[model samples]
Target: MIRSGNPALKESTFLDLGTGAVVSRNAGAMTLNGTVNRTGILLLLCVLTATYTWNTALTPTGELAPGALLYILGGAIGGFILAMVTIFKKTWAPVTAPLYALAEGLFLGAISAMYEVKFNGIVLQAVLLTFGTLFALLMAYRSGWIKATENFKLGVVAATGGIALIYLATIVLGFFNINIPYIHESGLIGIAFSLFVVVVAALNLVLDFDFIETGVEQNAPKYMEWYAAFGLMVTLVWLYIEFLRLLSKLQSRN
Candidate 1:
């Protein structure tokens, strides 16, 4: 018998969607493996982004030209599409991974061009620093020096989410010709916030590592490589941006 208005009813009996009990369990397990492959796919995306950004920033005309805006716009649109595909298409990893990489490359290229012009050699410095931080974090994770407990992971996620919200709000405020004064000129507070964001980004790598280990142990499906790579790419990209911004803020203070 079924009961009405019951939120805790046996979901299997009502919404099983015809998948047998055994298959459902198997599918649930595969999800663990999928996470591993996603990290690998993300690394490939990082390579693509780096290549594009390097070429754009190192060009003869470089950041001085107006043509770079087109690339930025294209990258933005492509990134949105990539996010949609990743979230909605379970089977789209293989196809969408490369596309996301290309789009991210275009976007990074234009942004890097501007930074390169402003800071003069800041691009390479940020790149080297970003990779160094990544390597150090990887070593720490492998050695079990910084275990990401549930609370740690939750805290990072919350902080990252808050940082994202602030960025979005800043973007929206820009349309009204208003800016967050502190983020640009509040001296110690701005530096402190940037430091916090960098820490949060580093912490995300721990979660990524945990996800990869879980996937490998669970023997995730083959397509999961793309998914894992995608996940890593997302984290690395965020980390790199934070690093670059931190450097810029520090340099400005000096």
Candidate 2:
């Protein structure tokens, strides 16, 4: 069973793909090159939309443009719905994958802009750190220096799940006027927690690489290139957000 730390790239995701299936030529087969190209396309789309929302947030008038918040909320809600749609209907990825990228770009842009406003240049730092981590892990994974063994996958999956649950609990508690600034504060403990989350989030990228490679080896359908690209985007978004949060906490200490 091919496993990944990314929920979107679960164990059974590619189970039914490429098994004794008649694959067409190179173009019809899911190759690493094709997936990389698709990933680049998705990233371009995301960056384009994200730039729009980023500029809208910091309009020339020196204040947030009207409806900035609406875009953010729309992106968040729309992205979630579209993600669900893509997951259940993998064949629809060629259509929904780009849409998901655009939607997430909107959400990421608005939130990142807000963070930038509060902490100058934080967005750049997060972006650089995100890509830096991505390349670093990709290299390590390619070199077999960081193998995603069963135990490794399990540990990362558990860590990711725990972090998700903590955030869920925090949100649930917020409704009762309760808060856990313990993890949001700039103190050592909060910073420590954020660091841990970032590490786990980064580790997910390794699993993503492993998952994509496995898909290729399994001869997954050509469209699965898009699906795999989408999964990588999901992990990248999560890692970028975690980096932003960690940087914000550190900045607050200044």
Candidate 1, residues 126-186, lDDT tens digits: the string is 7897789888988998898988676776676678778878999999999999999886553
Per-residue lDDT of model 2, residues 15-99, tens digit only:
4444545255464768899999999999999999999999988778546667789889999999999999988887889999999
Alpha carbon lDDT at 240, candidate 1:
77
- CA RMSD of all predictions: 7.2, 2.0
Give lDDT for model 1.
Answer: 0.66
In TM-score terms, candidate 1 sits at 0.80
TM-score leader: 2
The best candidate in terms of lDDT: 2
